[model samples]
Target: MSDQPPSHGTPYPYAYGPPSYAAPPPFRIPDAFGWSWDMLRVHLKVLLAAMIPTVVVGLVLYAMYFWRLVPIWIDMAEPTTSSTVQLDRFQDLWATVGLLYAAALVVAIPLSLFHGNLVRMCLLIADGGTPSYRMILSTRRAGRVMVTTAVLLVAGVLGTILCLLPGIAFAAFSMFTLPLLLDRDLGTFAAIRGSFALVRAHLGLCLLTFGLLIAVAYAGTMLCFVGIAASMPLGTLILVYAYRSLQVTGRTV
Candidate 1:
């Protein structure tokens, strides 16, 4: 062994936390390069683990709604009813179920966000960047993003109820909200408002980028679920970049 003292140094000199950068790039996420399959696969184990909580939350919400509402009206919903009773049954079927389901979903969105952020955090870590679950949790401004998200969700559901076409369009428009919210220090409302403004500002580009995502999703659905599990991550990563580009610079469609 050499008689030289090994120089002791911090793992990441001039940086904090792990040797990983752990923070987003200062400016913008690069186009077509923000995310990749290789990067995503490195994080799949994390994603799979995160999904357990999400699945559990979903099942809980479903169970809550089913148990709470089904017994209430199912007993009242007799098949052999007179014409007037049939009309009442129809009214209860459509309208009452609608209200109950809406209430159930209101409870579910935050749970879903929690799950999504879990995945997002893992992605950041796996991408060779150091980030924290604490920072991720702190990103939410409570009132801002949550309320905006809830409003938009209601609006989207309403749009879908109006017609399938508008629903598809609305869903497409909503593609970037998650990354935008997470990557920025945006309150819930600001993030949502910014998302809408960005989409409208670059309507064509937003539509096109998200359109490709839709096409991919459609193809994935057609090929059975394997395609979706593999492909969804890539598409989601694309959103991270796309949202960063739209917000960081006033790039037009």
Candidate 2:
């Protein structure tokens, strides 16, 4: 498929055909969820391997924060501490907190890169194409993926701050940015635009799929947060499946 967008009056490569008088097929949420679970079960080992770095990084950060805060809490709790000393310690603690946050964001860059590649791997699996570990970890398009992710994060944050509804709208619209960037090798902005166009073209279907996946993820979070180990990968598979469905039916722009 060409990376270039179709010109005015031209048909999109993945455009759906004209509709018939009959009703369209319904979005089967249960089937999609089941398919996600099946894919996760088949590739459980690979998915866990891919998630190791992220899980380790998170644990390390959490431990560091806990260790660092315990002493501060003890110091604050001491009635004998001088006001000046307490203020000085508090400033130091705040500075340390800022540094930790900066460090986390830096770590997140590579994590996002790996995640984008993992999404592509899932897409390949969904399409019946075998993808190797080396290919999945390859950095061929890491730059584009990282840039697109940063843009999405900023936009999503700004939209959420502006209004709750626009934030949800932006999140729903840009759901396919990573997949499009990986598969089409499009520029960051181009991929973002393509995601919006595609989701807009199939708004209702996209909304239902995205919402269901979000609901599943939320449910996982409620389960002492351990369920995310299963739900997160399942959500990714469902997304890749949905993307493939749209691609196969020429429903994506």
Cα RMSD to native, each candidate? 10.8, 7.3
Per-candidate TM-score against the hidden true structure: 0.58, 0.73
Tens digits of per-residue lDDT, candidate 1, 146-187, equal 665686688778888887778777777666665556656666
Q: Which stretches of candidate 1 lie over 4 Å from their true place?
A: 1-36, 61-82, 112-116, 119-127, 130-143, 158-171, 212-235, 245-253
lDDT scores in order: 0.57, 0.74
The numbered model that scores best in TM-score is: 2
Q: Write the per-residue lDDT of candidate 2 for residues 144-207, one digit (tens) a residue.
A: 7787877887787678779677878898999988888888888988988988888888788889
Window of ten residues with lowest summed lDDT in model 2 = 1-10
Model 1: how far residue 190 lies from native, Å: 2.8
Instruction: Write down the worst ten-residue block by lDDT for model 1.
Output: 1-10
